[model samples]
Target: MFGIKFFLLVTLPFVLRFILAFSTFAPVAAWPVWSGIKPRNSRLATVAEFFNLKDRKMAVDASVWVRAMHGDKSAFKILSERCESDVRLTEKIYWKLLPFVSRLERYGA
Candidate 1:
Protein backbone atom coordinates (compact mmCIF):
# COMPACT_ATOMS: atom_id res chain seq x y z
CA MET A 1 0.00 0.00 0.00
CA PHE A 2 2.81 2.39 0.87
CA GLY A 3 4.88 1.57 -2.18
CA ILE A 4 1.75 1.63 -4.36
CA LYS A 5 1.45 5.39 -4.17
CA PHE A 6 5.13 6.07 -4.72
CA PHE A 7 5.23 3.52 -7.50
CA LEU A 8 2.14 5.03 -9.09
CA LEU A 9 2.54 8.80 -8.71
CA VAL A 10 6.32 8.93 -8.80
CA THR A 11 7.97 5.81 -10.24
CA LEU A 12 5.43 4.79 -12.87
CA PRO A 13 5.36 8.12 -14.65
CA PHE A 14 9.09 8.23 -15.28
CA VAL A 15 9.63 4.50 -15.78
CA LEU A 16 6.67 3.93 -18.05
CA ARG A 17 7.36 7.03 -20.08
CA PHE A 18 10.91 5.88 -20.63
CA ILE A 19 9.89 2.40 -21.65
CA LEU A 20 7.12 3.56 -23.94
CA ALA A 21 9.40 6.04 -25.63
CA PHE A 22 12.22 3.57 -26.02
CA SER A 23 10.09 0.73 -27.33
CA THR A 24 8.93 2.59 -30.38
CA PHE A 25 7.56 -0.65 -31.77
CA ALA A 26 4.82 -0.76 -29.12
CA PRO A 27 2.37 1.70 -27.61
CA VAL A 28 1.81 2.45 -23.93
CA ALA A 29 -1.91 1.67 -23.88
CA ALA A 30 -1.07 -1.98 -24.47
CA TRP A 31 -0.55 -2.14 -20.74
CA PRO A 32 -3.48 -2.74 -18.37
CA VAL A 33 -4.09 0.92 -17.61
CA TRP A 34 -5.84 3.32 -19.97
CA SER A 35 -2.30 4.31 -20.77
CA GLY A 36 1.06 3.59 -19.14
CA ILE A 37 1.06 7.23 -17.99
CA LYS A 38 -0.37 6.29 -14.57
CA PRO A 39 -1.14 3.43 -12.28
CA ARG A 40 -4.18 1.18 -12.38
CA ASN A 41 -6.38 2.50 -9.64
CA SER A 42 -8.31 0.10 -7.37
CA ARG A 43 -10.27 0.27 -4.16
CA LEU A 44 -8.31 0.22 -0.89
CA ALA A 45 -10.18 -2.91 0.17
CA THR A 46 -9.16 -4.74 -2.98
CA VAL A 47 -5.62 -3.53 -2.69
CA ALA A 48 -5.46 -4.54 0.95
CA GLU A 49 -5.94 -8.17 0.00
CA PHE A 50 -2.66 -8.05 -1.89
CA PHE A 51 -0.45 -6.12 0.55
CA ASN A 52 0.28 -8.96 2.97
CA LEU A 53 2.42 -7.47 5.72
CA LYS A 54 4.98 -9.98 6.99
CA ASP A 55 5.98 -8.73 10.46
CA ARG A 56 5.93 -5.98 13.07
CA LYS A 57 7.89 -3.60 10.85
CA MET A 58 5.46 -4.00 7.98
CA ALA A 59 2.49 -3.77 10.31
CA VAL A 60 3.68 -0.59 12.02
CA ASP A 61 4.72 1.06 8.80
CA ALA A 62 1.47 0.18 7.06
CA SER A 63 -0.54 1.23 10.07
CA VAL A 64 1.20 4.57 10.18
CA TRP A 65 0.92 4.94 6.45
CA VAL A 66 -2.82 4.16 6.23
CA ARG A 67 -3.64 6.34 9.21
CA ALA A 68 -1.32 9.24 8.47
CA MET A 69 -2.25 9.27 4.84
CA HIS A 70 -5.83 9.92 5.82
CA GLY A 71 -4.95 12.48 8.53
CA ASP A 72 -6.46 10.16 11.12
CA LYS A 73 -4.45 11.52 14.02
CA SER A 74 -6.79 10.00 16.59
CA ALA A 75 -6.10 6.48 15.36
CA PHE A 76 -2.42 7.26 14.94
CA LYS A 77 -2.25 8.65 18.46
CA ILE A 78 -3.86 5.55 19.86
CA LEU A 79 -1.39 3.38 17.98
CA SER A 80 1.50 5.57 19.03
CA GLU A 81 0.47 5.36 22.67
CA ARG A 82 0.38 1.59 22.48
CA CYS A 83 3.81 1.61 20.87
CA GLU A 84 5.38 3.59 23.75
CA SER A 85 4.96 0.60 26.08
CA ASP A 86 5.90 -2.18 23.69
CA VAL A 87 7.51 -1.52 20.30
CA ARG A 88 8.99 1.99 20.71
CA LEU A 89 10.34 1.62 17.21
CA THR A 90 8.01 4.08 15.52
CA GLU A 91 8.93 7.75 15.89
CA LYS A 92 6.58 10.61 16.68
CA ILE A 93 7.46 12.53 13.51
CA TYR A 94 6.16 9.70 11.33
CA TRP A 95 2.69 10.55 12.54
CA LYS A 96 2.93 14.15 11.38
CA LEU A 97 3.20 15.56 7.82
CA LEU A 98 -0.44 15.39 6.80
CA PRO A 99 0.31 17.77 3.96
CA PHE A 100 2.87 15.39 2.48
CA VAL A 101 0.53 12.48 2.87
CA SER A 102 -2.34 14.40 1.36
CA ARG A 103 -0.49 14.42 -1.93
CA LEU A 104 -0.73 10.67 -2.07
CA GLU A 105 -4.50 10.52 -1.57
CA ARG A 106 -6.12 10.45 -4.98
CA TYR A 107 -9.77 9.86 -4.32
CA GLY A 108 -11.48 7.91 -7.12
CA ALA A 109 -8.00 7.42 -8.49
Candidate 2:
Protein backbone atom coordinates (compact mmCIF):
# COMPACT_ATOMS: atom_id res chain seq x y z
CA MET A 1 0.00 0.00 0.00
CA PHE A 2 1.05 3.65 -0.47
CA GLY A 3 0.87 4.25 3.29
CA ILE A 4 3.26 1.34 3.99
CA LYS A 5 5.65 2.54 1.30
CA PHE A 6 5.66 6.08 2.68
CA PHE A 7 6.31 4.87 6.22
CA LEU A 8 9.26 2.75 5.11
CA LEU A 9 10.76 5.62 3.13
CA VAL A 10 10.62 7.99 6.12
CA THR A 11 11.81 5.48 8.73
CA LEU A 12 14.47 3.46 6.85
CA PRO A 13 17.14 6.19 6.73
CA PHE A 14 16.52 7.24 10.38
CA VAL A 15 16.87 3.63 11.60
CA LEU A 16 20.03 3.11 9.53
CA ARG A 17 21.61 6.37 10.80
CA PHE A 18 20.70 5.54 14.40
CA ILE A 19 22.26 2.05 14.14
CA LEU A 20 25.42 3.45 12.48
CA ALA A 21 25.81 6.16 15.15
CA PHE A 22 25.50 3.61 17.98
CA SER A 23 27.97 1.27 16.28
CA THR A 24 30.50 4.09 15.82
CA PHE A 25 30.20 5.15 19.48
CA ALA A 26 30.21 1.64 20.99
CA PRO A 27 34.03 1.36 21.16
CA VAL A 28 34.34 4.84 22.69
CA ALA A 29 31.71 4.08 25.33
CA ALA A 30 33.14 0.66 26.22
CA TRP A 31 36.75 1.81 26.74
CA PRO A 32 37.97 3.76 29.81
CA VAL A 33 40.51 5.83 27.87
CA TRP A 34 40.33 8.94 30.11
CA SER A 35 40.84 7.09 33.43
CA GLY A 36 44.51 8.19 33.64
CA ILE A 37 43.75 11.85 32.92
CA LYS A 38 44.19 14.30 35.81
CA PRO A 39 42.66 17.79 35.95
CA ARG A 40 45.00 20.77 36.35
CA ASN A 41 44.77 22.90 39.47
CA SER A 42 43.29 26.39 39.06
CA ARG A 43 45.13 29.59 40.02
CA LEU A 44 42.24 30.48 42.35
CA ALA A 45 42.79 27.28 44.36
CA THR A 46 46.48 28.10 44.88
CA VAL A 47 45.67 31.66 45.97
CA ALA A 48 42.94 30.44 48.34
CA GLU A 49 45.30 27.92 49.95
CA PHE A 50 47.86 30.69 50.57
CA PHE A 51 45.31 32.94 52.32
CA ASN A 52 43.20 30.23 54.09
CA LEU A 53 45.33 30.21 57.23
CA LYS A 54 45.32 34.00 57.50
CA ASP A 55 41.56 34.08 56.90
CA ARG A 56 40.94 31.70 59.81
CA LYS A 57 43.04 33.87 62.13
CA MET A 58 41.17 37.02 61.07
CA ALA A 59 37.78 35.34 61.55
CA VAL A 60 38.72 34.21 65.09
CA ASP A 61 39.93 37.69 66.00
CA ALA A 62 36.78 39.32 64.59
CA SER A 63 34.42 36.97 66.46
CA VAL A 64 36.17 37.25 69.82
CA TRP A 65 33.36 39.42 71.25
CA VAL A 66 30.46 37.41 69.79
CA ARG A 67 31.95 34.33 71.42
CA ALA A 68 32.39 36.04 74.81
CA MET A 69 29.77 38.81 74.67
CA HIS A 70 28.64 38.65 78.33
CA GLY A 71 32.07 38.04 79.86
CA ASP A 72 34.09 40.97 78.44
CA LYS A 73 33.24 44.60 77.85
CA SER A 74 36.51 45.23 75.98
CA ALA A 75 35.65 42.52 73.53
CA PHE A 76 32.21 44.04 72.97
CA LYS A 77 33.73 47.47 72.37
CA ILE A 78 36.12 46.06 69.80
CA LEU A 79 33.23 44.24 68.11
CA SER A 80 31.16 47.42 67.93
CA GLU A 81 34.08 49.40 66.44
CA ARG A 82 34.79 46.71 63.87
CA CYS A 83 31.09 46.40 62.95
CA GLU A 84 30.70 50.17 62.39
CA SER A 85 33.76 50.34 60.14
CA ASP A 86 32.81 47.14 58.36
CA VAL A 87 29.29 48.42 57.54
CA ARG A 88 30.55 51.81 56.36
CA LEU A 89 33.27 50.36 54.16
CA THR A 90 30.98 47.66 52.74
CA GLU A 91 28.29 50.24 51.87
CA LYS A 92 30.90 52.44 50.20
CA ILE A 93 32.38 49.56 48.24
CA TYR A 94 28.96 48.21 47.10
CA TRP A 95 27.07 51.37 46.19
CA LYS A 96 24.45 49.35 44.31
CA LEU A 97 23.25 47.77 47.59
CA LEU A 98 22.77 51.17 49.25
CA PRO A 99 19.08 51.26 48.31
CA PHE A 100 18.60 47.68 49.52
CA VAL A 101 20.14 48.53 52.90
CA SER A 102 17.90 51.57 53.19
CA ARG A 103 14.85 49.41 52.51
CA LEU A 104 16.02 46.84 55.08
CA GLU A 105 16.50 49.54 57.71
CA ARG A 106 13.02 50.86 56.91
CA TYR A 107 11.70 47.37 57.55
CA GLY A 108 13.40 47.42 61.02
CA ALA A 109 16.05 44.72 60.48
Candidate 3:
Protein backbone atom coordinates (compact mmCIF):
# COMPACT_ATOMS: atom_id res chain seq x y z
CA MET A 1 0.00 0.00 0.00
CA PHE A 2 2.89 2.38 0.83
CA GLY A 3 4.62 1.65 -2.48
CA ILE A 4 1.44 2.29 -4.40
CA LYS A 5 0.94 5.63 -2.65
CA PHE A 6 4.57 6.63 -3.33
CA PHE A 7 4.32 5.84 -7.02
CA LEU A 8 1.09 7.74 -7.38
CA LEU A 9 2.38 10.77 -5.52
CA VAL A 10 5.82 10.97 -7.12
CA THR A 11 5.71 9.36 -10.55
CA LEU A 12 2.24 9.86 -11.95
CA PRO A 13 2.30 13.60 -11.91
CA PHE A 14 5.58 13.78 -13.81
CA VAL A 15 4.36 11.39 -16.47
CA LEU A 16 1.12 13.22 -17.01
CA ARG A 17 2.79 16.63 -17.09
CA PHE A 18 5.28 15.56 -19.73
CA ILE A 19 2.67 14.06 -22.00
CA LEU A 20 0.49 17.20 -21.98
CA ALA A 21 3.22 19.84 -21.75
CA PHE A 22 2.55 21.37 -25.15
CA SER A 23 0.60 20.96 -28.33
CA THR A 24 2.04 20.22 -31.78
CA PHE A 25 -1.05 21.14 -33.77
CA ALA A 26 -1.14 24.73 -35.03
CA PRO A 27 -3.97 26.86 -33.69
CA VAL A 28 -6.45 28.12 -36.28
CA ALA A 29 -7.99 30.91 -34.19
CA ALA A 30 -7.35 33.16 -31.16
CA TRP A 31 -4.36 34.89 -32.68
CA PRO A 32 -4.52 37.96 -30.43
CA VAL A 33 -4.37 36.03 -27.21
CA TRP A 34 -1.34 33.94 -28.16
CA SER A 35 0.51 36.73 -29.92
CA GLY A 36 1.36 38.80 -26.85
CA ILE A 37 1.45 36.09 -24.21
CA LYS A 38 3.60 32.93 -23.91
CA PRO A 39 6.72 32.64 -21.79
CA ARG A 40 10.26 32.99 -23.06
CA ASN A 41 11.78 29.81 -24.58
CA SER A 42 8.29 28.57 -25.44
CA ARG A 43 7.23 25.95 -28.02
CA LEU A 44 4.60 28.32 -29.44
CA ALA A 45 7.33 30.47 -30.93
CA THR A 46 8.88 27.38 -32.44
CA VAL A 47 5.59 26.56 -34.15
CA ALA A 48 5.38 30.09 -35.50
CA GLU A 49 8.95 29.96 -36.79
CA PHE A 50 8.35 26.63 -38.52
CA PHE A 51 5.42 28.16 -40.39
CA ASN A 52 7.65 31.11 -41.49
CA LEU A 53 5.10 33.64 -40.31
CA LYS A 54 6.59 36.51 -38.35
CA ASP A 55 5.49 37.20 -34.74
CA ARG A 56 3.28 34.12 -34.73
CA LYS A 57 1.25 35.65 -37.62
CA MET A 58 -1.33 37.62 -35.64
CA ALA A 59 0.77 40.66 -34.78
CA VAL A 60 2.11 40.96 -38.29
CA ASP A 61 -1.34 40.45 -39.71
CA ALA A 62 -2.49 43.49 -37.80
CA SER A 63 0.21 45.51 -39.46
CA VAL A 64 -0.66 44.04 -42.82
CA TRP A 65 -4.26 44.93 -42.20
CA VAL A 66 -3.46 48.59 -41.69
CA ARG A 67 -1.22 48.85 -44.76
CA ALA A 68 -3.58 46.89 -46.97
CA MET A 69 -6.52 49.00 -45.87
CA HIS A 70 -4.69 52.06 -47.11
CA GLY A 71 -4.16 50.43 -50.52
CA ASP A 72 -0.48 49.68 -50.20
CA LYS A 73 0.48 47.38 -53.06
CA SER A 74 3.41 45.75 -51.34
CA ALA A 75 1.26 45.01 -48.32
CA PHE A 76 -1.29 43.40 -50.61
CA LYS A 77 1.41 41.23 -52.11
CA ILE A 78 2.63 40.21 -48.70
CA LEU A 79 -0.91 39.31 -47.75
CA SER A 80 -1.29 37.12 -50.85
CA GLU A 81 2.09 35.49 -50.39
CA ARG A 82 1.19 34.70 -46.80
CA CYS A 83 -1.94 32.85 -47.86
CA GLU A 84 -0.50 31.10 -50.92
CA SER A 85 2.97 30.12 -49.77
CA ASP A 86 2.18 28.97 -46.25
CA VAL A 87 -0.25 26.11 -45.84
CA ARG A 88 -0.64 27.07 -42.21
CA LEU A 89 -2.18 30.39 -43.24
CA THR A 90 -5.90 30.05 -43.77
CA GLU A 91 -7.98 31.39 -46.66
CA LYS A 92 -9.85 33.58 -44.19
CA ILE A 93 -6.88 35.92 -44.13
CA TYR A 94 -7.06 36.19 -47.91
CA TRP A 95 -10.73 37.03 -47.78
CA LYS A 96 -10.14 39.70 -45.16
CA LEU A 97 -7.56 41.27 -47.42
CA LEU A 98 -9.77 41.20 -50.50
CA PRO A 99 -11.45 44.46 -49.51
CA PHE A 100 -8.39 46.35 -50.76
CA VAL A 101 -8.05 44.55 -54.08
CA SER A 102 -10.39 46.83 -55.94
CA ARG A 103 -8.62 49.98 -54.77
CA LEU A 104 -5.36 48.57 -56.05
CA GLU A 105 -6.95 47.70 -59.37
CA ARG A 106 -8.44 51.18 -59.65
CA TYR A 107 -5.03 52.76 -59.19
CA GLY A 108 -3.63 50.41 -61.86
CA ALA A 109 -0.74 49.44 -59.62
Candidate 4:
Protein backbone atom coordinates (compact mmCIF):
# COMPACT_ATOMS: atom_id res chain seq x y z
CA MET A 1 0.00 0.00 0.00
CA PHE A 2 2.84 2.40 0.76
CA GLY A 3 4.65 1.41 -2.47
CA ILE A 4 1.44 1.97 -4.41
CA LYS A 5 1.05 5.43 -2.87
CA PHE A 6 4.67 6.27 -3.60
CA PHE A 7 4.27 5.15 -7.25
CA LEU A 8 1.18 7.34 -7.71
CA LEU A 9 2.91 10.37 -6.18
CA VAL A 10 5.99 9.97 -8.38
CA THR A 11 4.43 8.85 -11.69
CA LEU A 12 1.13 10.72 -11.67
CA PRO A 13 2.66 14.19 -11.75
CA PHE A 14 5.05 13.16 -14.56
CA VAL A 15 2.25 11.69 -16.64
CA LEU A 16 0.06 14.74 -16.10
CA ARG A 17 2.92 17.09 -16.92
CA PHE A 18 3.69 15.14 -20.12
CA ILE A 19 0.08 15.38 -21.22
CA LEU A 20 -0.01 19.09 -20.44
CA ALA A 21 3.21 19.70 -22.39
CA PHE A 22 1.94 17.85 -25.43
CA SER A 23 -1.41 19.65 -25.30
CA THR A 24 0.36 22.98 -25.00
CA PHE A 25 2.39 22.23 -28.15
CA ALA A 26 -0.45 20.58 -30.09
CA PRO A 27 -1.57 23.73 -31.88
CA VAL A 28 1.99 24.52 -32.93
CA ALA A 29 2.43 20.95 -34.24
CA ALA A 30 -0.63 21.24 -36.41
CA TRP A 31 -0.45 22.61 -40.01
CA PRO A 32 0.88 26.14 -40.30
CA VAL A 33 -1.76 28.85 -40.86
CA TRP A 34 0.48 30.77 -43.31
CA SER A 35 1.02 27.82 -45.67
CA GLY A 36 -1.88 28.83 -47.93
CA ILE A 37 -0.78 32.44 -48.33
CA LYS A 38 0.55 33.44 -51.79
CA PRO A 39 2.35 36.47 -53.16
CA ARG A 40 0.23 39.12 -54.92
CA ASN A 41 3.06 40.01 -57.36
CA SER A 42 3.25 38.72 -60.94
CA ARG A 43 7.05 38.35 -60.62
CA LEU A 44 6.51 35.52 -58.17
CA ALA A 45 4.16 33.92 -60.67
CA THR A 46 6.80 34.24 -63.39
CA VAL A 47 9.39 32.60 -61.11
CA ALA A 48 6.96 29.74 -60.47
CA GLU A 49 6.42 29.43 -64.22
CA PHE A 50 10.20 29.33 -64.80
CA PHE A 51 10.47 26.42 -62.37
CA ASN A 52 7.87 24.27 -64.10
CA LEU A 53 9.07 20.98 -65.65
CA LYS A 54 7.45 21.89 -68.98
CA ASP A 55 9.89 24.81 -69.23
CA ARG A 56 12.96 22.77 -68.22
CA LYS A 57 14.77 23.23 -71.52
CA MET A 58 14.29 26.99 -71.55
CA ALA A 59 15.17 27.15 -67.86
CA VAL A 60 18.40 25.25 -68.48
CA ASP A 61 19.31 27.54 -71.38
CA ALA A 62 18.54 30.67 -69.39
CA SER A 63 20.40 29.39 -66.32
CA VAL A 64 23.43 28.64 -68.44
CA TRP A 65 23.42 32.12 -69.94
CA VAL A 66 23.00 33.68 -66.51
CA ARG A 67 25.91 31.66 -65.14
CA ALA A 68 28.07 32.58 -68.13
CA MET A 69 27.26 36.26 -67.80
CA HIS A 70 28.33 35.96 -64.18
CA GLY A 71 31.86 34.99 -65.42
CA ASP A 72 31.60 31.21 -65.75
CA LYS A 73 33.42 30.70 -69.08
CA SER A 74 32.52 27.01 -69.36
CA ALA A 75 28.83 27.72 -68.72
CA PHE A 76 28.93 30.66 -71.15
CA LYS A 77 30.57 28.53 -73.85
CA ILE A 78 27.97 25.78 -73.43
CA LEU A 79 25.10 28.29 -73.45
CA SER A 80 26.46 30.24 -76.43
CA GLU A 81 26.94 27.08 -78.50
CA ARG A 82 23.52 25.78 -77.55
CA CYS A 83 21.87 29.09 -78.50
CA GLU A 84 24.15 29.98 -81.44
CA SER A 85 21.66 29.17 -84.16
CA ASP A 86 18.80 31.10 -82.60
CA VAL A 87 21.11 33.98 -81.63
CA ARG A 88 22.36 34.29 -85.21
CA LEU A 89 18.79 34.25 -86.51
CA THR A 90 17.80 37.02 -84.14
CA GLU A 91 20.88 39.06 -85.01
CA LYS A 92 20.06 38.73 -88.69
CA ILE A 93 16.53 40.00 -88.12
CA TYR A 94 17.83 42.84 -85.93
CA TRP A 95 20.40 43.95 -88.54
CA LYS A 96 17.80 43.85 -91.25
CA LEU A 97 15.58 46.14 -89.17
CA LEU A 98 18.40 48.68 -88.84
CA PRO A 99 18.45 49.50 -92.58
CA PHE A 100 14.63 49.77 -92.69
CA VAL A 101 14.74 52.08 -89.65
CA SER A 102 17.36 54.23 -91.37
CA ARG A 103 15.19 54.43 -94.50
CA LEU A 104 12.21 55.45 -92.38
CA GLU A 105 14.23 58.15 -90.60
CA ARG A 106 15.46 59.55 -93.94
CA TYR A 107 11.87 59.71 -95.27
CA GLY A 108 10.62 61.34 -92.06
CA ALA A 109 13.39 63.93 -92.21
| TM-score of each candidate structure, all chains considered together | 0.24, 0.29, 0.28, 0.23
Residue range 29-79, candidate 2, lDDT tens digits = 121212211113323333233223222112337468566666677787677
lDDT digits (tens) for residues 18-87 of candidate 3:
3223433332232232222332343534545533444344335688879999999999988887655454
lDDT of 4 by residue, 3-109 (tens): 87765556544543343333323222122222211223324224233223122122355677778879998997786665764455445434422322312224553
- TM-score for candidate 1, residues paired by index: 0.24
Tell me, by lDDT, which candidate is best: 3
lDDT of 1 by residue, 8-77 (tens): 7787667654553344333324344324444244433222232221223323556776787798987678
- Which stretches of candidate 2 lie above 4 Å from their native place? 1-63, 96-109
Off by over 4 Å in 4: 1-62, 82-87, 91-102, 106-109
lDDT of 1 at 103: 32
Clashes of each: 0, 0, 0, 0
- Each model's C-alpha lDDT? 0.44, 0.39, 0.46, 0.41
Query: Order of all candidates by lDDT, from best down to worst?
Result: 3, 1, 4, 2
Better of 1 and 2 by TM-score: 2
Top candidate by TM-score: 2
